[model samples]
Target: MKKTKLALALTSAVFASSAMATNGTNMIGIGAQSMAMGGTGVAAYFGAENLLANPALIGKSQGTELIFGGTIFAPDVSSEHNLGEPASPGEPVGKDSSDANLFVVPSAAFNSRINENMVYGIGMFGTSGMGVDYQDNGQMFRAQSALQILRFAPALAFHNETAGIGFSPIIQYGALDIHYDGSETQYGTFGLEDAGHGMAQGLGFGYSIGGYYDAAPGLTLAASYTSGIEMEYKGQLSSASQPFAEFGMIPEAFDDKLEQPAEMKVGASFDMGSLTFTADARKIMWSEAKGYKDFGWQDQDVFSIGAKYSTKSYWLAAGYNTGDNPIKEQDGTTTEGATINFFNNTFFPATTESHITVGGGMAISKKATIEGAFVYAPEVKTRVGVSGIGDDYPIAGAASGDYSETKHSQTAATMMIRYNFD
Candidate 1:
């Protein structure tokens, strides 16, 4: 029973917040334009997305605006495990993993001038989480796992020609699911009788603040901060463990809180002739987040640069984004006499480091416009010990203290339609 509980705890430790971008589960940018420009918007014009990117910029909004959009995210992810010496000779020495899938994320926003000095708007978007399906692969950790968070925010802004400020209160809802076949006992004797899986729904609250200033005639500076939200999920678990046993192994009440980390961003935009150039720096405080910190995940730094040129009825944009990996690679030997590194974050691999983006906008008429963007992140691979976040690989049906490696890559395309009012 103790062994069963331990396994359950391991499974519970797999909480990853939102989507996994270079910013560690957060998207590189908030809107189609932002995504196209390497996620930069702090000081640039991005319509209603200012609610999520930088509320203060909304103070500079003109007329009335509405936008709706979605991103088709396709990710390729895989893993591999190395057995130092097969427990049974003639058995396979190393194994490759096939799992993880594609996803679609949606967004919508609207903004209106409340008066000469104020603007109001609301937006809904997601850094939609990721999942893995390793059901067919035997003995691999995590038979299946998936998580995602969606946010809706309403914003108010006050601004003048020289400066502006804005605020947005955020409401968030999310779902989580995890499953692991327990029949293999290389780690413990708990098998199908303990076939473990947990499913739950949760809600949370947060807020964001932003400021923008026209530093000079043609230059603008902007800054924003988003507070973290504390979330507690209530649901059911398949494991007949402590929390699950209290309710007779049915859909009992299992509770856990995953703290979303705060974010800070600052940037500047320059208007030169028909072109606007922008640069932004962002930080994600993963160390302060609940599940991430416990897993030894580190904070991430993101730097972006982009440029856009406007014509009478069309615009073209491109940008680049890069960041550090949050999950640290593990090295050294495990207690079971196996050497490993890099695979430490297999369960929650949110480790894409850079992106290339390109996009454009076309005016369909005096009142409507269409914008589209494409983003690509090259493949990133990491190798680590199979023990998973630890030095001892006690997994059943495999060699003790084996090695595990994972690779992650993605491509995304997004489109948004905006309507304007005089």
Candidate 2:
């Protein structure tokens, strides 16, 4: 019993420490080196961290290696709306910032050469998530939510002089919680009350495949694909709570399953003396995913470019990444559409669209190196229901009004230490 309790506690803590969504519910990159280069690792070799990006790159390693790293993520998110009439006179319905702003995402990886033509690796990473805390904002609904995900990947790669291929089987763990205040008599003949489902957890499995070819002495091309991971957080979306049962607002078909979207990436790298340049194009299939599709999310295309200058003992890197926000304004003409829009803005606002990254690494010795990176995503603002819909959208359980706006931005810093054992 004690051992089981301890395992549960550790699992909870690990899930709580996961990060907010950056690129369509996924992190821009896995490690400091990849992040500093705008997450462009499909064709560039970056040691053990490559397990998540392009496992084939691990085959480029000359020896065994271990890496430990963490990211400090901070997101600034706020929401404002007059959609619902005040429950009481002068209840202060204005802009409110989310308190779920800071988190630490940790990662570790180990890679070793099995033979002249084979390499193997394993990695554990806090991959993606999004959440908000509006409970302290004094808003009528006091909406709050949290979604977190972590992944463990074990991979194998085969490589020869100028080509490499790899595969990774992934195990994923996820947690979700949602809460909101509702009103009685808001729906014609039904009563809606506040609801909270502490936290729902689940596990899923997936896979990734990648390959790289050295086309010439100084150029390389690569591509990778990650399959979607399907998870079911029981009692999260289809709970027997007041908002779901009493009011019958959410559709029964919308169940408790939320699938992580699949991703495809293609990239190229050119090396010139001591300088290297890389570019990557990626597609996130959110529109085809189960849960996000139900929430009206669209597919996203992301582009990234990076440059690095290296010396005998140190290296400097910089890059830029951009993507269209997957979530867009929904049709407010209907109560069902308006309700979906309301939840999208209030609970899961993953709206940041651009990122600037800078980083560097220094060699401490022949076997040890330290690296760090910083990422900044400019603020993005979105507004829904600009035109008045009605006074009562009971499906949303709040007063319907002219519009609601959400502003989101983020910053993250990562640090890592690597050791090579030859």
Among these predictions, the greatest lDDT belongs to 2
Q: Judged by lDDT against the true structure, how good is candidate 2?
A: 0.76
What tens digits encode model 2's per-residue C-alpha lDDT throughout 1-422?
11111111112211221145378779998898889998788898889998988888899999999999999899888777665565566452456788889988889999999999999999999988876676665452555677888999999999999999999999999988866554422432333245556799999999999999999998999999999999998876554233333333332323677899999999999999999999999999998876677566789999999999999899999999999988777676555445555556655667788999999999999999999999999888887763333434344544456666788888999999999998
Q: Report RMSD for candidate 2.
A: 6.7
| Candidate 2 C-alpha error for residue 352, in Å | 0.5
RMSD of each: 4.7, 6.7
lDDT of 1 by residue, 1-422 (tens): 12212333344424322234446678888778899999999889788976888988878878889999898877777665544355576553334454555677889999999899999999999855757666775555445767778999999999987999999999998787766654553433434333444677888999999999999987999999999887765442333233334423323333356678888999999999899999999998988876456446678889999999988798899999999887665443543112213223445567688999999999999889999999988888766654532333333344444455677877888899988986
lDDT of 2 at 127: 88
